[model samples]
Target chain A: AQSVTQLDSQVPVFEEAPVELRCNYSSSVSVYLFWYVQYPNQGLQLLLKYLSGSTLVKGINGFEAEFNKSQTSFHLRKPSVHISDTAEYFCAVTDRSNTGKLIFGQGTTLQVKP
Target chain B: DTAVSQTPKYLVTQMGNDKSIKCEQNLGHDTMYWYKQDSKKFLKIMFSYNNKELIINETVPNRFSPKSPDKAHLNLHINSLELGDSAVYFCASSQGAGGSLDTQYFGPGTRLTVL
Candidate 1:
């Protein structure tokens, strides 16, 4: 069974400040990693994903993530954030078996303050 | 157009009552899934259907039943709902199953409250 753990439950930052959301996963087999953001009362939107090639993957809204095979981590980072970036972020993983069932982390609430 | 959509964005009902949530995808995806998000914001897969065929069925209670009328629609019917069943249910769809890296598009989610 594969699982994901988000190191932080909440992260607070000021506008224009950089932010990083840590994620770690445990899987014996190959896996795909993804980051999703859910705003207030809205469906989740894909932030980024790492399928193959290039440890550094860039995503929408100027967000990016690095897939560290050795560390088994896919951390999301943004050079600067805005108040609109405040939302619940989730890290998810799915094994290569093709079940397409995502194992998600507990989610980290990103609070951006002015 | 909405890639994925769920009906009855909010549902509040009394315990022991039965309710159903409907999901549809306009993306022409072959696989659809149901996920439950608890109060604490933890999400887990409940069931999956591919081309109207059941595939992944998690260890959810038997009271929770899923029906797929076609490749584009999947509906969940809950029987004798409990307070524990009060959570946000999400519907998702993907291109294919097994080794497909296609991103699963999610619905806005149906918030169910059991009184």
Candidate 2:
């Protein structure tokens, strides 16, 4: 079993400001990590994923996440944010169980203000 | 063309009533999943099917039954809905299981309101 913990429940920032959403996971085995974004009333959209290899993973909408194995963290970052970036972000994890089931975090609400 | 679609984007029903939500995926994926998002926006997996076979049921109540007639279509039938069931239901699909790292595409989601 795996669990994801998002340290920040809400992040408020002005437009064009840099931001980081922290995520930590606890799993017995190796895992695959993912970040998803959801608009006001829309479903989730894939932001980025970390399968293997490199530690730095870049995603859409100028978002990037670094997978630190030693720290058991996959923190999402954006150099600059826009007002349109106001949304909910979720961090998920899954292992090689081949079940295709993902354990999601509590979610972090990013409020980009002007 | 929608990759993954769900019917009845919003469902409003009374308690003890039976209702069903339909989901379909045209991405030719082998795996389909159902997730529930609560009022606080907590997303949790409810069920998963692979090629018309039940693969995972995450301690959900038996009242929530999922039927997969084919690889592309998966329907959820809830018997005796409750107020706690008032949440957004999302349908998603993936190419395969874990280790593949295939992204799961999601539908628009069906908001069910049980009164």
Shift of residue B106 alpha carbon in model 2, Å: 0.7
Model 1 agreement with the true structure over B1-115: per-residue lDDT tens digits: 9899999999999999999999999999999999999999999999999888888999999999999999999999999999999999999998976244878889999999999
Residue lDDT tens for model 2, A1-114: 899999999999999999999999999999999999999988899999999999999999999999999999999999999999999999999886778788899999999999
Number of colliding residue pairs in each model:
2, 0
Specify the highest-DockQ model's number: 1
> Which docking class does model 2 fall in?
medium
lDDT of 1 at A4: 97
- Candidate 1's interface RMSD, please? 1.5
Model 2 clash pairs? Answer: none
Candidate that would win on TM-score: 1
Q: How accurate is candidate 1 locally (lDDT)?
A: 0.94
Candidate 1 lDDT by residue in tens digits, A1-114: 789999999999999999999999999998999999999998888999999999999999999999999999999999999999999999999987767888999999999999
Work out how many backbone clashes candidate 2 has: 0
